[model samples]
Target: MIGRIRGMFILGLCSASALAAGTGYQPPFHPDQLKGPPAGRPNEVLVLGSPHLSGMPDTFAPAQLEPLLERLAAWKPEAIAVEAVSGLQCDYMRRNPARYADSVSSYCVDTGPAQAATGLDVPAANAEAERLLAQWPATPSAAQRRRLAAVWLAAGERNSAVVQWLRLPAEQRIAADGMTDALVAFLDKRLQRRDESVLVAATLAARLGLERVWAVDDHTADSPTPKEVEKAAADAITKAWDNPYSKARAAADIPLYANVAQPDGLLAIYRAYNAPESAMQTYRSDFGAALVEPSPQAFGRNYVGYWETRNLRMVANIRDVVGQTPGMRLLAIVGASHKPYYEAYLNLMHDVQLVDAEDVLR
Candidate 1:
C-alpha cells in the first residue's frame, strides 16, 4: 500500500465543504469500503507491468529476464494472467471481420491445425480442457500433459499450451493422446518466440508447477472505423503526444532498453516502469494529453473511450478467474502503459487487495 489509497468508511458530508472544482461531488459510499465475505482470506493481486518483449532490441536475450523472473518467482503467485486476447473473444471477432479483422490478425494465433488435431474448435476445446483438468491427476503422465497442450492450443491459449509443453519431460514431448505431429511441431516452434507471455508468464507457471496461464486480454471494444477517421484520430493523438513528458520518457527508455542485456539491467527497467511517478508521467504524456486534443469529431475522446473500455474488459476477464476461487493469489503481466489503469480500476473491487508492484519487484 506504499502508493495506493484505501477506501474510507466514513463520509465527510457533515462539517467541511465538499464543494466543486470543475463539477465536484464526492460520492456517498465507497465499494472498496464494503470489503469481503467476512470469512476466508481476501484475494491478493499483483499486477506486473511489462515491456512487450516482442518489441525489445535485437540484442535482447531471454536469459536477461532471469533477475526479474527470480523476484516474481519468490512471490509464488497461484494464478498468472497475461495480456493477450482470449481465444473465445478472438473467435467472436473472427466471425465478424468487418469490425475486428485487423485485431484478429494482430493479436490472435492461427489455431486451425490444433483444432483439427483435437477435433474441437475454440469453445469445445476450452470445455474439454476444463473437463480434463477437473479430473486431472495429482501426478499426470507425459501423454496427459501433451494432450493438455494440444487441447489448450486448439482452445487458442497458446501460452498456456506452452506451459503444458514445458512441464513435460524432454523425451515425453511427442504426438500422443490426441496430439498430432503437426501440432507438436507448431508448439515447439511457437515456444521459442520471445513473447513475455512465453518467456516470463508461462515459464514462471511451469516452474511453479501450475497447470496453465490465463489469457485475460480483451479487444472486444474494437470496431471498424473509416479510413479517413482513423487517420484524423491518429494525427490528433500524435500531435498531443509530442510533449515534453513524452520526450523525456523516450529519453529514459532508450538507455534502459540499451542496457537490458547487462547484469541486473532488466531489474532496473522494471523498477522505473513500476514506480508511482511513472503513472502520472504516462498520463501527462499519453492519456491526459489526448483527453484535451481539440478534434472536431472528438477523436481524442473516442481514443480514450476505446482505451478505457478495453482495459475494463481485460480486468473483468481477470476478475472472472479470481472469483472462481476464494483467497487466490493472481499475478497479471501486462504492458507498462496499462499498469496505472489496471491498479486504479481494480482497487474498486470489494474482495481485492492490491499488492504493490514495487514491493514485489524489490
Candidate 2:
C-alpha cells in the first residue's frame, strides 16, 4: 500500500491534572486515536474535477491543456476513469449498436464507416482490437499500427485511434477515420475538445504506457419525474444557483478560467476546489438546499436522492474496475460537481485511500 497511512494506533488517555489546569482547553487528539474498521488492501484514488470541454465557450483554446496533461502524465496512474458510461463505446455499441448508435454517432466517430473499413462488425472489431493490443510488441511494425488504428476506430475509440496513429510512421498514418495528418493535429482540429475526459484520460494513459481507460459514470439512478414536479425541481435548483453565495462562487471561477492556459495557474484553482472545505460547500449548497425546501411534494429532495444514488453507483463501478489489485493508484476525471461526492463515497470504501488531488496536481 504505497499511500496508506502507516503508524501505530495509540490511545490518548485523559489526565485529571490537564483537565483541572484549563477551563476551556481540550487535550490534543491524533488520527490514530479514532477506532475504525479493519484495514484492508489500499487503493489510492485521485479524483480530478474537470470542465466539459465540448461545451467550452468560443474563447477557450486547446493549447491551454498541454501543460496540465504533461503534469498529469508525470503522476503515472495505473488506472484512469472518465465521466462516461462504461462499455458504451467498446462493449455496448458492439452488442447493441441500434440502441447506442445515435449517441456514438453524435459524440464520437461514426461506427458504420469504421466497421465497413475494417471489414468486421463492432464486436468482432473490438475482440480483434483487444487481441492486437495484447499481442503488440514493444516496437510494432507500421502495418500493425495501422491495424490497431483501424480496430480502435471500428470500436468507436477515437482516442485510442489517435494513440495508434501517433505510433505509426508518418507515411503509414493516413486520413482514415477523418484523422487528419497526425494525432496532435486531429486532436487540435477534428476533436476540437481537448478537455474531454476520454481524450485527456486516453492520451494520458497512452503516455504512461497503459492499455485502457475506465468509464465509471452511471445514470441509471436518474428518476423519472412528472412534468410538473420536474419543472418545480428545476426552478428550485435555478433559484439556489442564483443566490448571492452561489453567485460569488461562480464569480470566483473567473480567475480560474482566465488561467486555463497555464498549468501552475490551473493547478492552483484545482487544488483550492479539491479541498475538504470545498466539498463542505458543495454539500451545503447542493444537498442542504434540497433538504430545506418546505414543499410537501419533496421535489428538491427527489433530485438530491437521485444525485446521491448516482454517486453511490458510480463509486461501486470504480471499485469493480479497481478489483483486487492492491497498491494500485487510480485517477478519475469527472465533472466538478461530482468530485466531492466521489471523494466522500470512495473514502467509505474499506480498501480505498482517497488521495488529495492537490498532491498530484502539484
Highest TM-score among the candidates is held by which one?
1
Which parts of model 2 have CA positions greater than 4 angstroms off?
Answer: 1-42, 55-59, 89-110, 119-122, 169-171, 175-190, 222-229
TM-score: model 2 vs. ground truth? 0.73
Clashing pairs in 1: none
Span of ten consecutive residues with least summed lDDT in model 2: 1-10
Q: Each model's C-alpha lDDT?
A: 0.84, 0.62
Candidate 2 per-residue lDDT, tens place, 1-362, comes to 10010100011112222224447765685443442443554677888887667755565665666666877887778988887664344355434554444334433445666666677666687788778866778877666666777676666566666566544566766654433234335433544444565457776776787756666776443222444455555666555445555666678788877766664565566666776677767666666665555454554455555667768888888988776466688998887778988987777676677777777666
Give the poorly placed runs of model 1, Cα more than 4 Å off. Answer: 1-21
Top model by lDDT, which number? 1
Please give, for residues 283-329, the per-residue lDDT of candidate 1 as tens digits: 99988887677766665556666677778888888888989998999
